[model samples]
Target: MLDRSESALRVVVRSKFYRSAFLALLIAGIGLSAATPQLTLFLVRDLGTPLPVAGLYYVTNLAAPVAGFLVGRWSDRSHDRLLWFRVCAVIGSVGWLAMAAAQTVWLPFVISTVALSLAGGSMAQLFAACRDELSRHPTKAENRVIATIRMAFTVGWILGPVLGSWFGGVFGLRALLVATAACVFAQMLPLGGQRVERYEDPGISPLPEGRRRLDHMMPLLVFTAICVLAMTGDTIKFGYLPIYMAEQLHVSDSVRGAVIGIQPLLELLMLPAVARLADRYGPLRIMTVGAALGLAGNIAYATSSSVGGLFLGQALTAGLWACVGALGVSIAQQLYPEGVGTASGIFLSSIPLGSAIGGAIGGIGVAIIGLPHVFFVPAGLTTLALVAFVVLTARLSVRMKA
Candidate 1:
């Protein structure tokens, strides 16, 4: 039994589908993370925009994920996933092209909103494609594949800020925007061969002859919604943390960079362990713990008076974030035995949706109530999310027993 179990583990570790998924995630993380941190800096420092105005600029970005969700659902009904994905990438490139030409914040902001929305659409399509691939090889459990994806994203983030800082020093922010667009387009490269059967829900009911398996997928949708709310709190740190550090505590750029850099590296290192825990303890438990961590981390940030306090708080939050992020998708995948394409689109788009919400809220808080309060909002939200997560898990557990 021990030898058989060890062999099964080895097969999972060496699977090609998981390997490709990890690579796609890695490329995504490195590219987006490298470019995004510097966007506000570009607006404020380079374009001579005020912080409040920059905040508003971020507010407009929330529309992208909504559009992505809609487009993804539509695609599930009728559309070529790869073709639409490529088109969205092209649109994302155009957004960058416009940003490169901007002399004012409005121009870049307008383009970024559209471009980001398109990028969201592209990501939705990409995930649906990945889901299709995973389903083909679904004989094995998928928890590790999900963790591998999150780790890739963290790895990208590790690269993102370093690259942003470097480009900000060399070619200026506009050039960096152009470079980001180029990378998004480059992500369009052929991933090579599709293996899984595309999932299509029969209808909405399993009773009727041609009816769909609605009950099987409903739990997944509920979980996805819960994840969306939890993620909203999780995303605040990235979009606003550096600015918070700089403004509230008078942190130097170098220190801010270190704090930001530390997050992804920590995530990259800890994800495998978190993945193991998700498998052993359960994804639900892992996610609940993550939400609690978010609550604590945000509260620490809100009350902290020192730089070390901030970093430590952020690090704690990152560990929890990794746990939830790694497990959430796996849970969602398990929920949808059919309609992997639709489910992947819905599940993946939640992150961008949450980020959009967090960014808008964080931007507003920074502009009005102040930086310290930014953490407070996320803390409150995360606390609420923890309650929701607990309730959801409890219900799921009950269902499993019944």
Candidate 2:
């Protein structure tokens, strides 16, 4: 088995196309990840926005991905992946500029939200292009490639927050935004004058005589909804976890920083193993495991008093999140074959929306019930999502067979 896998890796790495695309994705991760948690924390801690309000700020930004979805869908029909990616980069850069220049909270909110939405929204389109270009495999191999692409973003997440914290702490939030914009520019350099091949829109269905019908894609709409629901449980940890750590565990700001830094690193570290698992067991099995781990971790968090307890819970949560983040994109790739760009946009948007909802719930729970309750709600929600994931995926497997 090891020999077979090594042989496969050798074949793939030898391809110039895969290497170039992977390099592009690696650079892209550095830029896109830079602003994520830092911006939210800045708004809450420095800008004096309350937790719930800060959450709403993020929720507003989620609309940008929705726009990306619409734009990507249109691009799909036109078969223009490169055009969409470029447009998204331009819009995202402007958003970062807005973040850097805004005098008031609302101004940054507007700019950052739009910028994040567009930039993030276009990622699916980019992956779709990459996937189409690398369509050289059986189903399992293709799924592994998709999983690896998503894992690349986990690497971005690992770096983004650490850099954001170091830069934001040392210089300022504005400087961090500018740096992120610069990264975006650098990442875009490789794609210059390259025409991206767009895949068949996954949103489209198979019709009579082997033609795909749009109506058959409706099941995927629900699958996307499930993705959104599961992700909310995730976002809560990102947007509100720092505050909770500061207040509940009474950890120092630096310790809080360490905790934040730890999550993405753990996630990135785990992806290769998770990717192998997804290939062997299928995405549904991996997702169910992720959801269950998240549920248990969050529930344990509710009872945690010591810092060690929090760390244990967080480690489990982060590991599970890594699996979902990688495999979710793979599933999305399968579901939205034709409209990959648009579908990717739609799929990516769910994370922020989930974050928004989770943040809102956490904020309210912290304020009224206490921090432990905040942990409890997400745990419960994750458990429900796990059950749903199991049922849905089991049904999806059946549908595929039929």
Q: Pick the candidate with the highest TM-score.
A: 2
Per-residue alpha-carbon lDDT of model 1 for 131-159, expressed as tens digits? 66555555333455566655766777777
Write candidate 2's Cα lDDT for 1-402 as tens digits.
Answer: 123254324434665545555666777787767777677676776677776566677667557556756766766766566777777777777777767776666876776556666677556667767666655333345545655666666677667666777888899887887888877766667666777666453445522223343454455566666765665656666656676778767889878777667767788777767767776777777878888888778876778777777788778888677776777766765665655665666666667677767767776777877766678887777777888888888877743311
Clashes of 2: 18
Candidate 2 residue spans exceeding 4 A from truth: 1-12, 40-55, 136-139, 200-214, 252-255, 399-402
Q: Looking at model 2, report the run of 10 residues with the lowest lDDT sum.
A: 205-214
Q: What is the lDDT of residue 159 in candidate 2?
A: 70
Q: At residue 121, what lDDT does model 1 achieve? A: 69
Q: On a 0 to 100 scale, what is the lDDT of residue 392 in model 1?
A: 80
Q: Provide the lowest-lDDT 10-residue window in model 1.
A: 1-10
lDDT, candidates in the order shown = 0.67, 0.68
- Score residue 210 of candidate 2 by CA lDDT: 31
